[model samples]
Structure formats: C-alpha cells, structure tokens
Target: LEIQKKGNEWAVVLDSKYNRRIDANTKMEVSGAAKKEVLKDKKFAYGTFANCANGQTPWGTYISCEENFDDYFGSSDENLKFDENFKRYGFKTKSEYGWEKFDERFDLAKNLDEANRFGWIVEINPFDAKSTPIKKTALGRFKHENAEFIVEKDGLVIVYMGDDEIDEFIYKFVSKHKYVKGGDTSKILDEGTLYVGQFNGNVGDFRGSGKWIALEYGKNGLDESKGFKSQADILINTRLAA
Candidate 1:
C-alpha cells in the first residue's frame, strides 16, 4: 500500500509499482527462536493477514500483527481434538472464513502447527518492495492489538503491546541489543525479553504501581515441568505463560 502527493492533495496509489499486498497465501520466513522450535528449521510461514492494528520502528519498518487468525482454519471431525495449548489459544473445530476448504494447511487435522505460525508480529521494510517480511515470535504471540516502540536514552528499544481482550493483559519487549543509527535493526525484534504487566493495588486506585513480569525460560517455573522447554516455548505460548 502506498500514499503519494497528487499535486494539490495526497492520494492512495493502488496501482503503483511499489504497491504490494500480503494476503493469506503470501509466503514469509519465521525467524528467531520460533524457527528452531515451532518451525523446526522449516523457516517458511504461509501468509500474514487479518491485520487489525500496526506500529512502526525507528528504522522506518512496519510491524503488521496477525489478529483473529484462528477464524480462518479448522475442521469438522468430532475426533479431531486439540490439546490445552491449542484450546487456550482458541483454535476451533470450524472456521469462519472456511479457508481449510481450499488450503489444507488451515485444517487442524492436516497441519496442526500451521495455526501456530500466525498471531505474530511481522516486520516488513516499507522502503524495499522485494524484502521478505519476518515473523518476530520472540515478542510473544496472542491477539495483539498493536506494538508501539520506545527508544530509551541508552538506545535500548522497548516495545509496548496489548492483547486486545477484556480479561487479557499488556506486554512489553526489551531488545537485547541497542539501536545504532543507520545500522540494520531488522533482527533486533527477534532477540528480546518479553514481559507481561502486573498491576498492583486496588482497582480504583489511579496511583497504582505496575510490575513487568519476565516471561523467560526457567524463570518463575517456566521450564520443562510446566511443559516448556526453552524461551521459544514460553514465547509461543505467551498467553499461557502470562
């Protein structure tokens, strides 16, 4: 999508050479720890749609979030049961969009892990039309409302996000590497610490203090005993970890 100045006013350019659309069939790469665990070296992820809100990085890149993606895939088999993790993320037995009718990847019985590939913060370089968007799973996964960034004075990037649900929580991600001007920050999102918000004090207290709980592996019992192996598992099941 492109917007350009048309003499007197700005207009949306639908047919511009730089105009691009990423639908359900677009192919993308799943980077970071998720590539090793969830994808298991199958680096590719199919498409990124159902984008509701978005944010931008200081380096002029776009982060398109995948929300309500579970409505696109499913099956009707009564015996097709899902584990606690799948049910926790709200994967249903029938899809609203009925994408499974055409793409088998949408079918739970056909590709169980395919649904896990969505609901991530996808990064795209708006300046480069040929750039392949990366799915940053380390930021954690859920029905993300948006991801806004704040560059600290020390150059550390902090991403603030919300899960856009009534009883859900807010999250933040602090980049492990500081942002250097003119340097490639594309991979920065892939390496970060994700934290969930924990508000203290009474509900009506406007002066309440909030704490950011670290959702890292081996911390707070987020380990093998809890069915999580590494930081990747904690991120992939962020809602459960929170």
Candidate 2:
C-alpha cells in the first residue's frame, strides 16, 4: 500500500480497528542484517521522502526502488568515481542532479546505509502494511527500471527487467519455485535465482539477440570474466553489476 505525509507525522490506516501514526522518527522494525547479524528490535525506517513506484508482485507485494538517493544523503564535492567498466559501459561518475551533500545518510541518505538496505526488489505486503518490506536480492539490480511478469504457456513464470540507462544490460529471473494456487507471496519472492544479460557485438551492432546468464551461487557465480553475481551485489551496485 502507498502511503505518504505532507509534513511531520503520517498515519497508517492498517485496518478498520487499527489506525497507527508513523512519523519521521517513528520507531519501526525493518528487516536487514548489520554485518550479517539478524536484528529483532523495531526501529524507524521512514521519513518525509518515501516516494515509491506502482508495481505489484505475483505474491502481492509493493516494490520501492531508491532513485536519487544522493538527494537526501546530501551532495558530494568529490568527483564521482568510475572504473574501466564505467568507461566500457558509457557511464559518467558525475551527476547533474546533485543532492548527496545535503545529508550524508541519503549518501546511500540515514541509517540510509540501510538505503543499500533497499535497492533489491523490495517486497511490501500491502495487505499487511505493518509487514516489513523485504529486499529480494534474488532480483539482481541496476536502476531496476521495471519488473514485468508473464506466464509461459506451460505455466512457468517469467520476469523481464530493464536497467534504464544508455548501455545497461537487461535481466530476467526465473523462479526456482513454481507459483502455486494458494501460496504465500513473501515466501515465493524470498527464494529465487537472479540473472543478468550479456550482449556481444561491435559498437554499432545492436540488431542481434543477447544471452541471459545466471548470476548464480557457487560454481555459477558472476565474476569479472563471466559478469554478474549474488542478487545482493547486483542490487547494491547495479550500475556496475551491469
């Protein structure tokens, strides 16, 4: 469910019996591991700038991508950093919409290091608004332009995702688990494989088809030689991952 506030506190109309008020400093329980340890206490996870998108999952969750995080994190005077990959892929370290300097947290933006906490396809159980949004790294990363789902003739599930940049690659995640008639959406999303696309051709050759490779685990991982990796890495450094 999409919720927002004009200034100060915003109320979450959870149900006919439960109407809760959440503010910039509202304590909440967000799902994530700090240095890999599971935290159970509820802490504040939202504030004034909670703009999200309009995409729903088959399992029934809302995905919110963190675009322009630099805006809330504050702006940086230090030149944006780029590597060979950036040059090969035609990306600029410099950004026109500078906002990283205003707030250091938005630099990711607050416990906004938690903002990397976001990025992965976030799963929000709109049916249960109090449910913590789960970032599905299994979805890979990039700008996460969009997630499109289509069922195959044989009843398989297929998802198409675009990176939304000049030369960024495309991605597709085929679930290891099939969609069931009455399955839990959160469980289905939490478990799946992620992949990234690799196109081979000369600078001007854009007419041929490309290949989709799994950024799988262990033997089938994404590396410098083959490209791509765990969904977490892909989600955190999506631009570079592509």
Clashing pairs in model 1? none
lDDT tens digits, residue span 1-242, model 1: 78989788999888777788777777788877767676754757878887879999988899898888888878856479888778877888888888887788888888888888988989988877888888898888898889999999999999999987678999999999999989978678888888999988765656677899999999988999999988888888889999
Task: Write the residue-wise lDDT of candidate 2 on 1-242 in tens digits.
Answer: 23457589775544433233333333333332121221223343443223334466665556554333322333243454544433333333333443444445444312324344333445555566365555555565345566777666654567777765576777887766677656644445445555778876656655665677765434344554645443344444555554
Q: For each candidate, give its TM-score against the true structure.
A: 0.94, 0.61
In model 1, which range of ten residues has the least summed lDDT? 34-43
- Look at candidate 1 and tell me the lDDT of residue 52: 79
**Cα shift from native, residue 106, model 2 (Å):** 2.1
User: lDDT for model 2, on a 0 to 1 scale?
Assistant: 0.49
Lowest lDDT 10-residue stretch of candidate 2: 31-40
Deviation from native of the Cα of residue 9 in model 2, angstroms: 30
Per-candidate RMSD, Å:
1.7, 7.5
Whole-model lDDT values for every prediction: 0.85, 0.49
TM-score of 2: 0.61
